[model samples]
Target: MQKIAFQNELTISTVQQRNGANNTKKDVRKIQSWLTLFAMTNAGAATATGIDGDFGKATEQAVKNFQKAKGIPQNGIVDQATFDLLAAPMRAAFLSTITGTDLRGLVVSAARQHVLNRPFELVISQQPNSGPWVRAYMDGNEGREWLWCMGFVQTILDQAASVVGKDFKQLMPLTYSCDVVGTTGLQTGVLFRYNQIRLNPALMKPGDIFLLQKTPNDWVHAGLITHIGDDFIETIEGNTNDGGSNNGNAVLSRVRNFRKSKLDVFSIEGLV
Candidate 1:
């Protein structure tokens, strides 16, 4: 495996700036191109097809080809598990190839260790899945409460603070909103609004939180700061199903480079 250098350690302000720059159509296309290149590289496919991050026919066809080769369903869609599998080996190789320091590995390892150290909480209502551990904190039951991914992020933040003997409250006012086409609000902790704190994935340090914006609803998903390599990120998140049944419970999993339409990658309070 080829080792790659991790990104620089980033602050909340810096992350916000990077995310803000992504608002333009050109930037979005650039990000999509990057993602397409990333996916093609791992899927053992050809990037010359010019998928270019559009998620159009070319990308879909590439996904189908990869799926057929992998013997998973030829769904033509890249779900979480498939995304993880495709990127994992390359990421591992990249990390190993990087020299000078093992900062990326250390960060990822720390996040995994943090999840293992905590007791699993039941995701009763919002997330009605059964798993070995609690992935995130859920608000209400299936029909009632909404599943707030940010809550889970907050939970992990709280746990990290406890380990360091710091007050989680001090980490407040973190950016917890998303920037979608028309929606905007500070009330929702999951979405990133304009002027929210953002971080650069390449500059993220250990204990920094990465916020992801879910499509359509524009909800946010949180992951603890871990490893940041040239091509991927390693994070430990709870309540992530990875295409499995919700009953699987929470556990530490490595997340490849995040590929979302509009996301905010920044720190809130804990890491400074």
Candidate 2:
């Protein structure tokens, strides 16, 4: 699939500035491209009418059509609310009655499907259910490449939850931000943050998550705990390569130092 071409990446500050009536001609074009790609597949007249950075009648109408479909206000402007609404992509098939009685086991079972080092070509640009690994994860959501770690974890939770007829959101909050996951887990009485979990080889369990930290309050990477030992912990993490760059391109099952790495741990009991 052809990527949405742009000179630079969209940042939170830029996104905030581009919303509503504050949008410039350039902002409008970006919005037009994103909306058309998200809701209408970027072809035909499905909001695909604008690329000239002009919020003309066609752009306005396209925004309105997107708003109408999303059940948001039918204002022909790109507001923050509208931008937020466009973030969610479609979900793939929903499987009911998971055969695994164990929640953590189910998560591991579902996670085993995607291989490490798999490329983005198979993951991006496809119909809801058609794409293999990436499409299956993140509820078949798409966009903003390189943020697949959270999606990978979320997909495991979803697949495991589906087996037991439980809503995935109810089991665990899904988010791209590790801090958000940590915060939500604490608020919901479902997760123990880094210092609280009391991690040791004996204390850790399978299917629990480890949040590798960037700061005490900010977490940068996360992965499932598959095994624990005296000196190291085994993990299945997404977006990590053999060199252990947290921002790498693929999922990997790697071993980490037991005590030296800065990290946070969460129990699976809260999710189960």
Candidate 3:
């Protein structure tokens, strides 16, 4: 298998920022990115300054606006308190360590947190699929080439497994390709085709990775199953929006009908 590009380093620094001198700091870039994301997700929220890693007047005014909306002091500077709120979503993912025999539940919880946090992509520098969340999920690389559906699934699995002293990589190859993940599941005797699931829906469970199958040998998209209903399954998937395209934007919770879609399941029972 090919190596996973861009190491999965999802973290933010608690550095303070102001208008002058600290303009080109790396943390400034992160703050700008968060400000942009916050503005995008929250309606009527403060927008960011161009995300050019420069803490100019526009960035300061945006920060002040954010502070005012949050009911904090509108000091126009990113102090520890302000930075904490800016990085809350990323921090929320690692806030608690899940402990339980229900590995599926744990994974589902992780995926839910991500969806609630509203991870979405932002076009940067005329490039698509670029942003803090996209870069974080895709390891470090983010662009048009990096469709991050599988990347999000892998990250959620890893997060849940690591909390219980287990490693998901032991069960499946570290990959961003749905086809690669599906192929590995087949080799490991864990892949359940849509037809199999159609006959026995009980075989599927929460946290089981779902792959939208294009062919018997090709899987196009991936996501984490959160609920298995009578004829539909709920999913928390990334790099997708409300339209449910595989290569879209945002982490969203969607209900998909198994009877209508060719969705395959990769059981993580062995890993748990």
Candidate lDDT scores, in order, read 0.40, 0.58, 0.82
- The regions of model 2 sitting more than 4 angstroms off are 1-99, 116-132, 139-146, 193-199
Root-mean-square deviation (CA) per prediction = 18.8, 12.7, 3.1
lDDT tens readout by residue for model 1, 41-107: 3556542234122455665565566666677897665544655444343234223322213333333
Per-prediction TM-score to the true structure, in the order listed: 0.39, 0.55, 0.90
Which regions in candidate 3 have their CA more than 4 angstroms from the true location? 1-19, 97-101
Steric overlap count per candidate: 29, 2, 0
What order do candidates take by TM-score, descending?
A: 3, 2, 1
* Candidate 1 regions with alpha-carbon error over 4 angstroms: 1-111, 114-148, 173-201, 215-217, 244-249, 259-263, 268-271
Candidate 3, residues 42-88, lDDT tens digits: the string is 66876656877778788888888889878888878886668778878
**What lDDT would candidate 1 get against the real structure?**
0.40
